[model samples]
Target: MRIVHLADLHLGFRAYHRLTDRGINRREADVFAAFREALDRTAALQPDAVLVAGDVFHVPRPSNYALVQSQAELLRFRQKCAAPVVMIAGNHESVRSADNRCILELLTAVPGVQVVTENPEAVTLANGQVRVVGLPHNSLSRLNTIDLRPDPQVPYNVLMLHGTVDSSRINDYGGYDVPADLLELPWDYVACGHYHTYTHLGRHAYYAGAIERTSNNIWQEATEAKGFVLFDLVSHQAHFQTLHKPRPTLDLPTVDAFGKDVAALNQELAANVAAADITDKLVRQKILNLPKSQQARLDARQIRQWQTQAVHYLLDARPPTATLSEAIAPDIAASQGLTATVAEYLRQRELPKDLDRLHFVERGLAYLAQTEES
Candidate 1:
């Protein structure tokens, strides 16, 4: 059986400050465009099944635009491809309150689309050719209770989970770690998610990366390609289907300004900007060991002009006189953002049964991000 595996679509995910002409967030628009292309590509392949690992939405409650576009695009895929799609909920869309239901369950409204949001389900397709076990985010958190054995009756068993496998693609914080021993299970294939970079964990397991760049530290994933995985379980082949280029995100090489005066530093800056093609791209240039006087004397007008050439320009000039804490503060915060910290806190805290933790934490993080910008 052939299947197109996709994960971390992150629809409604927005970054930076740019907006589309229609007042929709530019990054959010980019994500939708990539998703459309992915659907188009999947339709062309005409796979027997489409498996979405997780993080279908950036948050538990996605925007109206995201919900509408996703429904339209997915329904189109079902109409054209005539295949069944199995989607599961990741941590992003998982609600902590037992009273409230997961938003991903609503995706089942579209025919031929099966959503496994809460419990574990074995979805048999192609009249018993394949058995896909949908292990959602919360279920993986309590792995011991689940019966992970493959269905003996099916020819192919594809295990799907929205959690981090034992790989470098694993994030430093707020990740659901699936043990290495678990991957050694005798399954035909394991389709994993939550790691935004495509990776081959073993002979049978693979991660289909995110469709678009959704992180503030876009440079961290500069080398990793964004796409989905097309695996033919019969032939034992997993091919990565790369999507069209989304918005460009570049992290220019750092400049050492140990002894250079203001004139020399500005000259280097001008040359650096001239050498790079940053037009309409998110660009960042760091000037390290910058002298206090040289940084102060740097021409603001020249920098402003450079900013005009790109979607956003970051002039990261750090002085040597700064304290240790001051130097690493931003890095610390970026490595574990307000959202991630809240996630970690929730995991450790003993919360009230009536509290809606997902809404409370996500709202607080949004407010904190806005305040930081202000």
Candidate 2:
């Protein structure tokens, strides 16, 4: 028996403000397309069963377009593919109990697709010779309370779940500290999700990761090697097959901008952008430790223009420092600072002479204004 393991599809996600032209989010379409391609590939491979660990949608309540796209893809899998797909809800989809009802209930009507959310359930596929024990997101709190342990009598058992593995890397997103002993169970394979990187816990435990570069944050590891894993039940060996979806990311040549002027910084930035190879990449550009004074000189329009022309993402990789804080203008930093500088600025001093004092006074007085005007 063969199974295609995929997880964290995150369909309907929208991102890259510049790349999205149809007034629709680019990430949404990319995500949907990824699943479509994966399904197509799965059909070609002719797997016996498909395992989607969790997080099929980026949000609990996906947009209508996303909903439609997801339905279409699943329908295609049911009608076209030879394999049956088993899926579950992850943290994103399990935000509310009501949210899971729409997708999970809809999937039940489909012949080849099976979805589990809210509680754990064991689905035994007699024809395929696979017994799947699935645990959805948010069920970890009640894991000890529940009595859903696998039957020792079952020979080939697979545990499908979505959560943060209990380890040093648990502090990251969507990660929880599940007892490490959970993997020590009698299950043959533990397929997990929520983390965007393909990883393994010991030997039997694995994460298939997200289908595509859903977020700019994950671009670093989003190399050529992106996609699902294929597990051969008879051989009991798993192979990570690389998906063809390409995301653009850029690495700007490092430059020390401690005392550089705006002109120098702009020159270097322009050169870096020009030199970057971003044909199919998402254009995640990183410039580290840029002088705050130089950054202050950048106009918002210019920044937007640079981002449009150069990359999908424009980021400052500078480490936060006291000198950097002092170098930047108080007004600029006030709006962009990590702390609430905008409120502090108003409390400290009166409005500047060039600035309209009336507007400031009106805003300040409006807070205390309660009476109706005649």
Candidate 3:
């Protein structure tokens, strides 16, 4: 009896908005293709059972197209692999309000799939003589007292779930705290999910991790080898099989604008981007410590056009400085132009692009003015 353990597929996840030549988000396409290949390999391996821990979608209410694509992929897994699948809802899909139901539960109606999202449920495969206990991401209070202990007499038992372990680390998605001792149940193997990175918490307890890198923020955390785990019941050990994914990444050299001259900085920037070797891959450039003078030198029209170019990601780090308007703020007499100046300052810096960006810019301008006066 063999099993395939996978987690955090995160279908419908999109980042950095560079579309493919076909006008589709390349990142989203890569993720979908990764899962398709995983299922194809699982079919070839002929696993007896398959386990998907959680965070199947990046959001709770994913677009209908995403849901349709997901269902189509699951159908392929069932038909081609001929293995029963056990999946649970992670925090992203777990509804906090009682008035709402979980999307994972809807899959129960789909043939050949078992979804456990409400309560702790135990199922036994009479033919295979295997028992599986499933626990979902729910109120810690609910699972704390629930007796999850499996029958020691059973020949084979596995625990499948999506939640944090008892370690002091917080969940990267939602900060919900999970106690590690939850694995106290008597089972042969405890397969977990939630964290996007693959790791082992304890003996027989493991996180399969996400199938592919989700975003630029998470790219640094991704392992060079990507894919799902093959759990061989006969050997009673899980082995990770590397899956090949073709995506490009670029690392930009950091520039110390505060200390470097304009001529030297531009030469360095040109050489860095030119040497990046991103001709055939997805491109993301990071520019650090850009000076006001450098910003003034850049062609604004060209820069704005580059935003929609093949380059999928960009990060600009610029030190706050006094613009011409701020140098003579008293004479300006609180004109509306002040707001536009502030907005342009924040926008060109490539900040987080959230409300925090506005807050940071406001606070930074105040600090810079005070420091300059003193």
Query: Which number leads on lDDT?
Result: 1
Query: Over the full model, what C-alpha lDDT does candidate 1 score relative to the true structure?
Result: 0.82
lDDT of each: 0.82, 0.70, 0.69
Better of 2 and 3 by TM-score: 2
lDDT of 1 by residue, 5-53 (tens): 9998989998768788999887889999999999999999999999999
Compare the candidates by TM-score and give the number of the best one.
1
Taking the tens digit of each residue's C-alpha lDDT, what string does model 2 give over 108-144?
Answer: 6667788888788888874636899888887776888
Off by over 4 Å in 1: 291-296, 321-374
Better of 1 and 2 by TM-score: 1
TM-score of each: 0.82, 0.78, 0.76
List the pairs of residues colliding in candidate 2. 164-175, 164-176, 248-281, 248-282, 248-283
- Per-prediction RMSD in angstroms? 13.1, 9.5, 9.7
Cα displacement (Å) at residue 108, model 1: 1.4
lDDT (Cα, tens digit) per residue for candidate 3, span 208-324: 877887633554642345678787655678788677763555546555454456567666666665675544454444444565556677545544544554355354645544333
Clashes of each: 0, 5, 2
